[model samples]
Target: MDAFIGAYLGVLTLPNVSDLDGELLIHVGVGRTVGIWRARHPGDARALFLFRSELGYHHHGVPRQKELLRGAFAGMHAHAHRWVYELDRTPAFYFDSITQLRMDRTSLG
Candidate 1:
């Protein structure tokens, strides 16, 4: 964790970002829809969240109008932290951790 943080802060001696992965907080409009997912490549072994956006009947993989952060879209950590602050201010909605969606593959057939 420290190594990744150092790299992000540009304080590391070497730009060694091994094992560092970026994730996303997908939102369509406001409370209408929300979900989380990790960026993936086709050559990757598999994915934790095989996310696909649903627009009435249309389904898509990636989000449009993205604001890049850390070589990818903004991560879940930043979004989650902001959500906490907003909750404290307005207390409008509820949030929960859905940890059941493990990002690692542990099953074998």
Candidate 2:
């Protein structure tokens, strides 16, 4: 897992991250394996959380926006999008929008 995180961060490091606010958050993990990681890192928050399982996965926070999540993952070769939104006590509506935008951007090469 250390290597995976390191590689993931290394990829992110090369990108131009001028903003790190309520933007999209992308995470890749194996099916239910993400839950385990999330359990260990409870402090982390995401607007959109995409979990990929052999059978399928779940999209929490926003139900109607599942299509957007699928579109975001369409091009990726990975299992799913593990998006984390930092609400910071903010409302759910606002955070959901922010998460979608971040997910959209992260999907682009």
Most accurate candidate by TM-score: 2
Question: Using lDDT as the measure, which candidate wins?
Answer: 2
For residues 1-109, write the lDDT of model 2, one tens digit per residue: 1111111110101111223344443545443222112211234332334333232222344443444344444544442332322112223322122121123344555
Q: Put down candidate 1 lDDT per residue, 43-85, tens digits, no spaces.
A: 2211112112222222222122111111222244454324222
Q: What TM-score would you give candidate 2 relative to the actual structure?
A: 0.24
The ten-residue window of minimal lDDT in model 2 covers 6-15
Q: Residue 39 of candidate 1: its Cα lDDT? A: 27
